[model samples]
Target chain A: MADHKTKASAKTSSPSGGEEAYVPPALANLIGYYLRIAQEASFQAIRQGTGKSDLKPGWYTLLTILSENPGVTPTELSKLCGRDRSTLTSTLNGLDARGLIARRRKAGDQRSYGVKLTAAGEAMLRKLQVIARAHDERLDAIVGKDKPLLMTLLRRIVDELGNGYPPPPARGLGKTSRTR
Target chain B: MADHKTKASAKTSSPSGGEEAYVPPALANLIGYYLRIAQEASFQAIRQGTGKSDLKPGWYTLLTILSENPGVTPTELSKLCGRDRSTLTSTLNGLDARGLIARRRKAGDQRSYGVKLTAAGEAMLRKLQVIARAHDERLDAIVGKDKPLLMTLLRRIVDELGNGYPPPPARGLGKTSRTR
Candidate 1:
């Protein structure tokens, strides 16, 4: 896809006789368009920064959540991560296999399990934290002073649009809630 | 996954004796985290609104680009949609198979093909426009008067962070450009 910027000019004439930077008016102003594009860009940067590592993108969040909420069950991890249960289960399995997480039977319920980071998991997370922090620093530089406001706006979207529609709250038992 | 919110509480003790809405302090403040969640929420909303439709999410963007820039080649469409060439090729094949788009050789370039929507594609896009409009309306209600500001923040992320890292401009021939 490296040829995207130049080869795209095949069908159109630019004022400079080169690539014409055009986005249709229809898409130019859409918030969703920007949201998707921005997220994609941000995500790509994270992957590039982390490179090949023990923790994948979503895994870092999951492990971080576990670090704060140790013994958190698979279900709670799912909501905290916003990933479905099956997906979370598979992810946990991967972590377990790698000795990054440990799953034990819940205190009162043999059928249910409590998931927590193992020593290895904590070690891995600590390493990833440095990478994550650097990633955040770059984001901070990009948004600069607007960082806080941008976060509020993004949170507002999640609060409104996230709950506004649904598969009706997704495999969960309570109203979707996120403590700030 | 419907059990996500409820089942997730199994391992954690909540003040309410139910699902704990706690997020790790580490992730709670990161812009990348929110961006991913917000985008996922918005993307899910779009899919739910559009329901079962001929055009998929990204496909709508591609078709819209094609509608405005008819005769666009695969390379240009890839950049406009921010998709790589191979992904765009398969998507184009699907659209072509559905009789929604047509691809023909460029006037002077036999090596490349220009893609345009057929009457069906146009009709489908028009139908999607209604759904897209409704989606935007909900977003409007969510963001309200701050919509423009939110857009600026998002675009800044895309512009700065998007090019800040690199796969080195994707398979493009020239510098990345987009007309406002």
Candidate 2:
């Protein structure tokens, strides 16, 4: 079993000479097993990095996308974040009130609005980007040389999983999404 | 950019002569981005599979752990699932009410209880296990033969990230946890 092997290897190879290795269930062999836990770590790391900030849990994703595609529609942005429009509105409104993002009707398409990062929004994004970079660096330090390997696997899972499964109703990010 | 390349590749390589390929943002390069979306997919799959089940989100992990380790302690289960005692209590009580898990004082240690799966619990777990396997197969079909590769990569991330970052309150699973 994977748990048995990991425990045995840890017992023989550990420098601490103690019970450092944990015996995980057989389900640990599944990708779902690790996703649940690793996602928790990722969520916590983001919280630690963005603590007490005005941005909500999913805000950074919104800002990052808006920065990349300046005239993106709210509906398209909602699709990108895999969030429903209603859940996204309050966060978008918060950013708008803070003057971090601006919404305007497109010249030709009055039905849809273009969302963009303002000068202040861009400035805030720069700060958030720094925090994200540092957080990512910490993950890289742990994942080490396999960091790229892990990224490829995750990205592949996202693409492949997306191919098969319809996105769930984005109800506050399943378990991780929350307002600060 | 990752999205640009994806958009370009999709534009050029589309056999359907249409736009099925999605251009993910720069954040898609990060593990958190994929985790959030993948977790959404996993949640929907499970919800669809277990729509009327009384068991909540964290119940599967609890049942899975109990079935594996018949006399495991709550503290140990908490450690394995990365949940706190406070959060585990509510879930444990629900399982207890359902007569799925039994908590009894250890023969020697009068203070601590050793939790085990009841007969009904084991039966329910077997049924849930069926749902879990089919669900995993759906994911496997998506991830393809590379399922093992993705699983290994995820396991490494969990171990490596866990060493650096403490568990994130174990707030219902961040992604998905399933039976073996």
Candidate that would win on lDDT: 1
Q: Compose the digit string of candidate 2's lDDT tens values, residues A47-70.
A: 766767775555677788889989
TM-score of chain B of each: 0.77, 0.74
lDDT by residue (B1-180, candidate 2, tens digit) is 112122222221112112232445667566666666566556555656676677455577778878888888776676565554466778888889989999999898887799999999998888777777777776777667777767766665555654424333333422322111
lDDT of each: 0.72, 0.63
Candidate 1 residue runs with Cα over 4 Å from true position: A1-22, A164-180, B1-22, B164-180
DockQ of each: 0.36, 0.18
Expressed as tens digits, the lDDT of each residue in A2-42 for candidate 1 is: 43235543322212112223456898788887788778777
Ten-residue stretch with the least lDDT total in model 2 chain B: B10-19
* Worst lDDT 10-window in candidate 2 chain A: A11-20
